[model samples]
Target: MRATYPRQDPPRGGVRSWWGKAWQRAVEEAAYSEAELKGGRTAARRGEVGGISVDAGALLAAVREGDDAWTVQVDVPVLDASGRRSLVEVVAAESGRVAALLAGELPHDLVEHAEELGVELLPYGGELAATCTCPHYLAPCPHAIAVLVQTGWLVDVDPLVLFAVRGLDREALLSALHARTADLEEPPARVADLVDDLEIAADAVLRARHLLELLESDAEVPDSLL
Candidate 1:
């Protein structure tokens, strides 16, 4: 799935959003050299990057450096079915986490927890495959890097964009999330606080066996389990 974000007026600061900084860090760390990223940062700060489009496994943008205009694309591997479930499980672990993501804020540590569960919620910049219409031959030319910088802005506005980049669109995430947490919605309110040891043991065994696990949740299963 693809998600398009509108361009915003440039922010005075480099990146102030919670996930935006991490996005910037990933892009900067992936650079071949500081000098390679320097020009891109300058271009981005000057509002040369505009119109970001994100699809499963790819990011595209329009960048202008001086009189030249170029189209830039950066591709990253998207999550398969198992990976998506892993991500959903991680997010569904806490209602507050889902609330935070839907509210457009992603704490960096949330992704760290995801990493521990064998899910890569964010792409490693060094591993990105970038292409640009510019003359530069490097994978992430200045134009491409500039586009990534602008993409950080989009991530700030919608944390779900990260999911989209990893191949889960908004609706898919909601459906999967509901599926993962649906099981927890069962039980009467009076006894809902009790932990389900049997369910926990089963999930642990399934996880140990490399079986597909439902999304992690605490409540009873609701209708429509996937």
Candidate 2:
């Protein structure tokens, strides 16, 4: 399915949360001056970023600057195949988590579990890098920074965007989970076996009730039966 990035006000701690702060820090480190960083933040808040496409270890967005359009690209490396498999294993280990993610919810616990599995879903410290077609010479000029900020907002809504930036889209991840769990599932029980098991249980229950009745009546039980 084509991914969606619904417009939204940045979440609480928009620049303070792990993902948000990390992106901000990376952008700050990359920027040449505070003015540029401040301008980028303003653009992001003003919703100048749109047509956001997140995949292939990059985020592509367009910015409208007074009738002129600038293309912005944020490049970050995604996990290798082995790392992706490790994360998939973590998700598959908990079917409920997989179900939640597939249903379009990003659970905090799932992110925690990914961390424990050695998969860092969000970029950290100096990991973010960017380029934009604007006239500014900085690596992540205001346009690029705006795109990055908007991407962080998208990440808040769906952690899978983080994965998508890491080169593993939702469909691919779910397919991996299905493949991993397929062999782990037990075959369905046969009808005959289920019926026989139920019948045996019923007989045992009847015998127990009969013995209880006999004890209550103070009846003498046969020695052979005992």
Candidate 3:
């Protein structure tokens, strides 16, 4: 069976929430996948390096907390032209907890590179505000925009991914999933891929029969049908 789409939260205060806007954009631009988002090209200068890596499952787990705010450390790998790797650490903060992190309440180093990557720990109540360190004055330079687009897709699959960048763990996420569906006896089975050619053939036959019926009713063709 196909997975059912989740119900979206109602718009509030005559404005759509950042999360809501992200979701709408994602459905509208459903061209890229999670892997493509994470592994795509970067805008690092010839000798410069920076990259973003996120665990979608873990991030979604953190977002599910709603009232509870948490932080996580993400190691983004930046590479040079020669494939040399350098790590940049980011401290991701969640809604309601952004103030704390912003005020230096969190116990992690918000690396300079992360701040440059236009990383923002958006709160649940506000829009996703970001500032990039790239030379471009845009809130999200092309690189940051690419990352944000990918992040949106991740949230569609698992809302907690919104927090995963902030440092949520996998085991903790699984526990949360268990709690959400604790009463279910077993997990649902996965849907198999459809045979495209077979579906096309069936549709073609159906259309042909309908057309033949219409022609015969109008006395435009013989009753015999193929």
Candidate 4:
């Protein structure tokens, strides 16, 4: 089913409201003008964030598949650092997937985990697709909305912090893989060269001994005593 929700406007008291503070910080970090944040909010109110809108039904389907439970899709507006706007389609998964997708693209590891859990991410194309099995269909659907709103508050604290919830955890995963791959490779070729050189020296010693014995026999003047 298709539904629309009004984009939330930034609170008026500048940075007083959580979203306002987030917008202010994002603007500062992005080096974008205050005018841009205002413009972005305007665009978001029109239901465009990162150039896509979530399809409620499709999102619900993906979330249900992932969570192994039933859920309804809800619509919400989101704005990115660029001030571009789009509708975020969210569903409640077991937990946190919605947060990850909404904050940014899903990390490869998170995607892999979702797949392992038989959870499918709906087609977003810059929109968010979230899943929750609860039956609410409102724009935020209460539970899902709670997550989204909290996510916004979190962004105010540190925009990138959303990545942890989304399942990226890249630093730990990469370090482990690097250590494993290093262990699998051979030590080095220097050990092999040392072994070869030892064999050659042993052979040379044997050959020199044979040559000396032959020379002694050829010069056997001591036999005249017999």
lDDT of each: 0.72, 0.69, 0.33, 0.34
lDDT of 3: 0.33
TM-score of 2: 0.69
For model 1, the run of ten residues with the poorest summed lDDT: 190-199
Best by lDDT, which number?
1
RMSD for each model, in Å, please? Answer: 13.1, 19.1, 20.6, 29.8
> Tens digit of lDDT per residue, candidate 1, span 66-181?
78889988888888888888888877676467656666668666789889978888767775778999888666888888788778777766778888988997778766755554
**What lDDT tens digits, residue by residue, belong to model 2 across residues 78-127?**
88888898888776565466545543455667678888878887676356
Per-residue lDDT tens digits for candidate 4, residues 1-226, read 2222233333223234333343334333332244533443443333232211223222222122223433334332333312110111112222443343333334445535544554432212123334456564432333333233323433343322332223222232223333433454676354334434544654455455446645656855334222
What lDDT tens digits, residue by residue, belong to model 3 across residues 1-226?
Answer: 1111222221123222344354435322432344422322231111111223454212111111223322222222222212111111232222222232222133223323333555433222113333334344433333343344434433433433444444343333333333434444655221101123333544565467556646756746545444
Model 4, runs deviating above 4 Å: 1-126, 165-167, 173-226
Global lDDT of model 1 = 0.72
